[model samples]
Target: MKYFIKVVLAESYKQHRNYFNNKMIYVSLFLWPLLSFLASYYSYKAFDLEESAISYINSGNILVFLLIGYMAMSFFRSVVQSAWRFSSERQSGTLEYIYLSPASRLAVLMGNALSSVFESSVVMLVFGILMIFYNRESLHANVVGLVVVMPIYVIMALLWGVFINACFLYSRDTDFLFTILEEPMEIFSGVKVPVMIFPGWAKLLSCIFPLTYALEALRQVTLNNSDLGTIKITVLISILIIVVLLAATLITIHIVEKHVRKTGNIILF
Candidate 1:
């Protein structure tokens, strides 16, 4: 266990160091969240709503809403991006090198996930601070809910990574899948508005989205004053998702490992 933790931590730090060292990338990392904020502010402005109402809505609760949406996007982005990292390494002939290591595949993926977690943390912190300053609202963040729900959120995030990694292992062309998940997740997951506001059918469909559990969990803690019942239900669903996804990922990897051993088709030509 100690060895595995060291390996994951080392790998995570290496990835984080490389990524953070890229100045241009860092600039864009900060800018993307800002762009989301600007778009949310102006898009609402385009409706010609009263300036005070718009300010109240956008800078206050609405701004938090937009930030949370982007936060979910950040998680999705991390999962997809981490999956593609494997494909990219394969193309560059490094995938096998990593796989040849003795570490568990899940450990390696967890390390990559840690990299994403770091990036997302930075994004959330920077933007969260900005939002707090702009809105001037006392955060009064829920410590216990944040602690409990975060693990579930991390597990749920892995589903996207595992699915994409499986797709890359088989087809090697998953851009369409990525695009498909992007919008519907943002739309149905209460990124822009409350999911309760959705029509019956839409709400039903959205309930299946992984982000639904995450948003609900976060909303209960942040908006509803740490509603334990809501958090418990969301945590349960998120745990189920993580288990299912992790199982699928392992199965897929085993199949691919077998195929590669038999046919030596490790690289797609």
Candidate 2:
């Protein structure tokens, strides 16, 4: 137990130092998300949100609404992109060395996910909080609800990253996951749009991403003052997703330990 904790701490420190060493990286993280957010906010300007199909959104609360979605997304996105960076381990042969070391693989993976998610989201999370509080007239969450749901939201993102990292670790050619998960998650996870009005087919597809559930619970708490009891089903589903992700992460890590990647890609004609 002590060693596991030590590994997690060491791995977390290493990830923060290695990737987050540059102050510009933090600025870019803030800038890119802020830019994407501004673009989305403006696009909705033409629409009459008062007459819009979605009940919770309005001109007054739109900024807070969108900020929450993007804030939550930063957590999930950071982890997925960071996990793909596990490829660096494979490329440097450090992955094999780490495997040979006595450290617990799961602990190391969790540490990496933890550091990435926290650093990636902290900037936006703080910004969102200030905005939400500034727009507190539009905000309506219970303190108890925020206390309960916020941890669930963080856990879901962490586990989601861990699951993705484990799958990427299974083989060298899994880079396609980065392609499939990154853009598609932002699109399908109801980050900018409400799932309520989505077509049945789209709704079914959205369920595949855990962010959909996290965002639902999140928006409800912030915009509707939804307490745990009110969002219990969403909370339940988030818990179930977290459990499934943890199990999948462990299973994938085991498989990854025994699997070996072959050298060289296909030769171009």
Candidate 3:
């Protein structure tokens, strides 16, 4: 337990030094999301959407809806970034040192994921505060609900990061897969639009992505004024997804380890 905590802190510090060392990252972290919010807000305004239509599609207050969507996307971004960083380590030959070390692979990955999540959360926090101030009149959410839902969302993202990192361990390049998955995930996971508006087939596809449930539960609790009981099923489903993803991550790590040992090829070409 002590060692795990140490690993997490060390990795977190490394992340701060490596990525947050730049003043530009601090600026871009807040600026990019703010730009995204503006783009979506103005684009929706171009449609001159009716109050009823906006309410139906976005659960009212398009700004708040887009704000939450962008915040959620930050979590997913953390997962992808962590996975990509892991792949970079492999490319740089540092992944072999990781494999040779006595430290727990899962612990190290969790540390990496946590650091990414921490950084992403900083971005989310800044945007969240800005949203609250700008849309103070329109925005409404139960503070208790946010307190309850956010940790689960973070855990889900971390599990996803671990799984993706494990999968990347077996691959030389992840660009093709990342390209195929990223945009579709943003769309199908309801980052910008309500999942309820998706066609039946698309809805079914959305179910395969945990972000769908995370967003649904978030919107329910925050925008729709849903009680914990109302979102119990969604929360349970997210937990189940976490469990399944953890199992998959463990299995992948075991397989990768065995394959590396057998083939003596830590970096796949």
Judged by TM-score, which candidate is best? 2
Error of 1 at 246 (Å): 2.5
| Clash count for each candidate, listed in order shown | 0, 0, 0
Candidate 3 per-residue lDDT over residues 1-269, each given as its tens digit: 89878876776687667667776775676687678768877887766546444353442477777778878877777677777766777767878888898777777777777777768557676767686578766555666777788888888988887777777777675556567566777889987777887899999989988888888888777777777887899999998999999999999888888888898777654
Deviation in Å, model 2, residue 223 alpha carbon: 0.5
Rank all candidate structures by their lDDT, best first, as comma-separated numbers: 2, 3, 1
Query: lDDT scores for all predictions?
Result: 0.67, 0.86, 0.76
Off by over 4 Å in 2: 261-269
Query: Which residue ranges in model 3 land beyond 4 Å of their true spot?
Result: 48-60, 267-269
Candidate 3 lDDT: 0.76
What value does the lDDT take at residue 257 in candidate 2?
71
Q: Each model's TM-score, in the order given?
A: 0.80, 0.94, 0.90
**TM-score: model 1 vs. ground truth:** 0.80
Q: Look at candidate 2 and give me any clashing residue pairs.
A: none
Candidate 3 at 153: error in angstroms? 0.9
| TM-score, candidate number 2 | 0.94
- Over 1-269, each residue of candidate 2 has an lDDT whose tens digit, in order, gives 99999998898898898889988888788788888988999998989899978777888889888999899999999999889876687777667777778899899998899999988778887887887788889876677878888899899999999899888886777899999999989988988888888899989989999999999998898888788899999999999999999998898887777664332211100
Q: Give the deviation of candidate 1 from the true structure as CA RMSD.
A: 3.9
